[model samples]
Target chain A: MRPDRPTADEMLEAVEEFLRDKVMPAVTGHLNFHARVAANVIASVRREIGQSPYIEADQRERLMQLLGHDGDWETLNRELCEDIRAGKTDLDDPALLEHLRQVAVENLGVDNPKYSAYARLKE
Target chain B: MAGGSIDAALEAATRKYLSATGIADLKRLSAGASQETWSFDAPTADGLQELILRRAPGGVPESRSTAIGQVREARLIQICHSHGVKAPNVRYVLQPEDGLGVGFVMDRVAGETLAPRVLRDDLYADARTKMAGQSGEAAASIHNVPMGELDFLEEITPLQQWQNTWNAYEKYFLEWSPSPVFDYALRWLKERVPARDRVTLVHGDFRNGNIIWGPEGLRTILDWEIAHFGDPMEDLAWICINSWRFGNIDKPVGGFGRREDMFEGYEKVSGIKVDPERVKFWEIFGSLRWGITCRSMAFTHLTGHDRSVERPAIGRRSSECEADLMILLGRN
Candidate 1:
């Protein structure tokens, strides 16, 4: 059990551990190599958060929430994260791609061509 | 490395060049992802001089090399100086083989380049009134850069030759970014790509920040990285882009002068009548282009190449451009 408002570092570390121990090992050999690298990235992100635990925590939380989980996302709360961590998710998936688009637009409240481009990709 | 060691290295470098024609007291300036600017006190044989050293950062965009490099910039400075365009004098360009990496030393022109400071400073209060006249003159002079002399830019198609600048944005976005907004803007832009006008050399990044203003008038025009032979109206539209207005939405053309003034200035020098529709087309394109540029900045942040608050803040400005585009295309 975690606090109602876990720090970004704590969330990041938990996500990293889950990805490494649970997610990475579950992937096929085809994706295992990529998963290992991704795991290292998660570890690096954890190290960065060790320097500043709270900076961009709001943005991080917003990112997690927009990914469809809110509050105390203990370990890779969404299926998309699990798939991404395992390197099993297709980058071309329209739904997942749209989710990424929404996150960018929601975080930065701008309606520029980039957003318009993303919004029209489903068509 | 320790601060003392860096300082010692800087001091040694400064002393090595002290007797040169330009100033040489080097002060470490803030580091940018693409370049590092150093402010230095330069004393020439003639008089005191302020100088700046611009060098590529350890990591820079690969795409940048195709557009403008130090060698090309030096050539542009030479051309501008000969034509009486207010621009910094290029003093020296260190070759790539030189241990300094890609860079040049130039005469540091005085005046505020920052938009907020330009708007707030009392010194420039009256200066704003003269901006229209100065900008007009400067633009005309820039447009008059001898086409025959600029052989390297022969590959750039003139305005009438280009149907859409959107393709450039599309290529950059598809190759570099995962942002979907780029795709959307591409579709919108493609649908509304305007007809071509007469081609002329375009000052690709001509706008407020690029122009230095002094008490007398426009002192220098900087950043010739994107200078290309394209529609002349491209420069006009770029100058009027809302983002360069710097929070001053009412007064376009960098929040200092009217579009008519800029047109009048260019007309006087180029001996060509300004086309209203052509300028309007580029104006819309300018907003679209800048919107894509903002996403590219955001992509840099997202990709973790650089993670500055300024980059993401700039990403937020893309929407302002979208609204502008909507109005331009009559969607709003």
Candidate 2:
């Protein structure tokens, strides 16, 4: 139903290019700051779209194993938060720690891959 | 905002309080959705004066959050200024007849509030070394503010504030989905609330970006809307929070100087020894609070309260906190 040549990622790339290369030259001050932010938003959207499925699948598997239950991503994550809050889950368990670390790192990949701390943690 | 009307209002308010006949070069410097800051020149009989106006727009209802609203914020400036704390001189609070919203006028201190310029620019190299200790001395002065005179500032312990923020964040964020790292942070913070019995004036948001500095050194601390009575260590720890460091994470004290320097400065001014454990606990507490704050930025955007590009962009930074929290927990 959709043309595949100009995919969602490509569309975002085009918009970012236009904003950075074309529109950016004409703006200054607060609007310029916001323009860069707008461009970054599009780039983030592209990353999120490309990366979310893999990240979510990995998270779902970890949550299911750690919580000993099967459910959708949001419901299980909500339960995980509640368990940790109410002292039902042990934070020090090796499996649980791995799950948390991987989840945090994967999300960082989508959100801010350039966050300087990430490089140190990965190493 | 009608510029002419505001100028007229400024003249009237200043004439009564500052004995100024007129204001010139009036301009709005920055305005959030709720508040506005204006810079202007006021001509008194002696000479020209630089002044600032911080105000809510007309007819905007007052927010009941723990923020020390405008008039009282002015009071903090006045109190600190009187005590030689390098704060601006609060000149006048707006009256209704002045046609301006509720706010106060103060002497505009000249310095750079921008973090990038204050950090990377050559003009601030000397200021950088001096900033951390200056920040500590400044905090000591703020904490030593007379207790009786600060009756209006909210007197609450850090633990209570931490719990309130954690609970609010849980309801706001956790209901949508689970946040393992955030929940872990909350539990960890609850267990280690600093064992401080005495209450002191706490500059609730003392951080690098909010501080004003120039070539010489730290000039003044700004944004006292959330000043409160709390464990003094909360202020000390808050300055060391990673978010305030910008990207210079190596130097924990506001990304400019050593933590020991801050302690030395604080002890020098107040003659009270800092409990290292208490500062450490508050540092963890600081990380948790900042992590929660980053999450709120996303929620604020999602709820349509503020649809700025920065909102969702900042929402992404919630993960940055999540990562930092893990590191702090020694999970790495």
What TM-scores do the predictions have?
0.66, 0.94
- In angstroms, give how far residue B204 of model 1 lies from its true place: 0.7
Whole-model lDDT values for every prediction: 0.61, 0.80
Candidate 1 C-alpha lDDT tens digits along B173-216: 43543233334434444444554545555678888988888765
Docking class of 2: medium
Model 1, residue B39: distance off in Å is 1.4
Residue-level error in angstroms, candidate 1, position B110: 1.2
Measured with C-alpha atoms, the lDDT of residue B105 in candidate 1 is 71
**Off by more than 4 A, model 1:** A1-123, B1-24, B58-66, B96-98, B158-197
Provide the global lDDT of candidate 1 against the true structure.
0.61
Q: What's the DockQ for every one of the candidates?
A: 0.05, 0.69
What's the distance in Å from true for residue B127, model 1?
A: 1.8
TM-score of chain B of each: 0.83, 0.94
